[model samples]
Target: MKNTILLLTLLFSVNAFADHSTSKFVWSGKCLNSNCTRSEIEAENKANYQKHLQHIQDLDAEQEEEDREWSRQHDEDQARADALPKYQYKPIPETDNCVTRFYEKASSIIGDNAKEYIDVEEIKSGKCIFGFKLMAEEMCEYFDSFSSMATPDWSEAEWCRYRSELREVYIQYSGLVGTSAFTDAVQAERKAKLKPVEDKHHKIYQNLYEQHLKQLKQ
Candidate 1:
C-alpha cells in the first residue's frame, strides 16, 4: 500500500510541474527573455523613421536649390537678349528700287568658307558690304511699305516707335557686322562720325571674337 501511494504521489508531482510551466505563457504576449526588449524595438523603429524623414527633407532641399539656380540662369539669359539692339523704320518715297539694289549687292558677299572668316572683319568694307546693306534695305522696305499700304489708321507714336525699333536693329547688327560703309567713297564721306562709332563697336566685336576663339581652342 505505501509503495502504491509513493507512485501516485510521483505522478501528481510530474503533472503539477507541467501545468505550472505552461501557465507561465498565458497569452500576455510579453517577451520572456533577455534577447528581445520592447524598449529596444521601439528605439530601432524611431531611429529608422527619423533617418527616412531626414533623407526626404534633403531631397526636397536639393530640388529647391536646383529650381532656384535654373530661375537665376534663365533671368540672366533674358537680360542679355534684351540688351541686343532693335530697329525702327521711317517713311521714305520710292525706296523699293533702292532697297532691291542694296539687297543684290549685299547678298553676293556673305559666304560659308574660309573666306567668311577672312571677310568677317571686312564685312562693312565694300567686299563684305552687300549682305548686311541689302538686309537693312529689305527690312526697311517691308516695314515702311507694308505699313503705308495697310495701316492708314496707325498713330504717329506707333510710327515713331517702329522707326526707333528698326534703327536699333540696324545699329545692333551694324555693330555686329561692321557694315557702315556703302563703299570707300561713302566711307570717306562720313569718316568723321562713322570712324568713332565703328572704332567703339569694333572693340566689343573683337573681344567677343577673341572669347569665341579661346573657347574653340579649349
Candidate 2:
C-alpha cells in the first residue's frame, strides 16, 4: 500500500513539470532579473527618461533653426518683389479705327479664309499643323515699338505708352485663343497663357533696365 501511494505521488510531480516546461514564452523587453531590487529599476527608468528629454530638446532646436531660415528667405523675397515693377494691364489705345486696323493686320497674317481652327501652320501639310510663331513675334514687336526701343531704358510715360500698345496686341491674342481651337490641349493652354506671362516678365525686365540706365548716368 505504501509503495503504491509513493508511485502515484511521483507520477503527478512528473506530469506537472512537463506541463510547465511545454508552455510558450512571451517576450516583454523586461530585464531578465527576477531578483532585481526596486532601487535598481528606478535608476534605470530615470536614465531612460533623461535620454528622452534630450531627444525632444534636440528636435525643438532643429525646428527653431528651420523657422529662422524660412524667415530670412521671406525677407529676401519681399525685397526682390519691391525692386521690380508692379505691372498692371493698361487699356488699349482709344484712337479711332484702332480695333479695325488691328484686325486688318492680324487677318493678313491669319489669311483671308478663316475657320474655327486657324490652321496655325500657315502652310497646310498633311494632318499636322505647326503654328505661326514668326508672324506672332513680328506683331508683338510691331505692337510694342518700345520693347527693344533704346535699350528698354524708357521713362514712366514711355513705358505706359508701350504697355498700352502691348495691351491691345495681348487682347487680340486672348480673343484668338478663346475663339479658335488648337490641335492639342497643351498647345491650346500655351497659346492662352504665353502673352500674359511674357507681358509680366517684360514689365519686370523693363524696370531693371531703366535702373541700369540710371546707374550708367551716375
Best by lDDT: 2
Positional deviation of residue 90's Cα in model 1 after best superposition, in angstroms: 10
Q: Candidate 2 — which pairs collide?
A: none
Error of 2 at 77 (Å): 1.5
Count of backbone collisions in candidate 2: 0
Top candidate by TM-score: 2
Name the lDDT value of residue 137 in candidate 2.
Answer: 33
Candidate 1 C-alpha lDDT tens digits along 162-212: 445545545643643445545676545455555555565556556666775
lDDT of 2: 0.47
TM-score of each: 0.26, 0.29
In the range 158-185, model 2's lDDT, one tens digit per residue, is 4445555666656655645645553377
Residue 62, candidate 1: Cα error in Å is 0.3
Whole-model lDDT per candidate: 0.44, 0.47
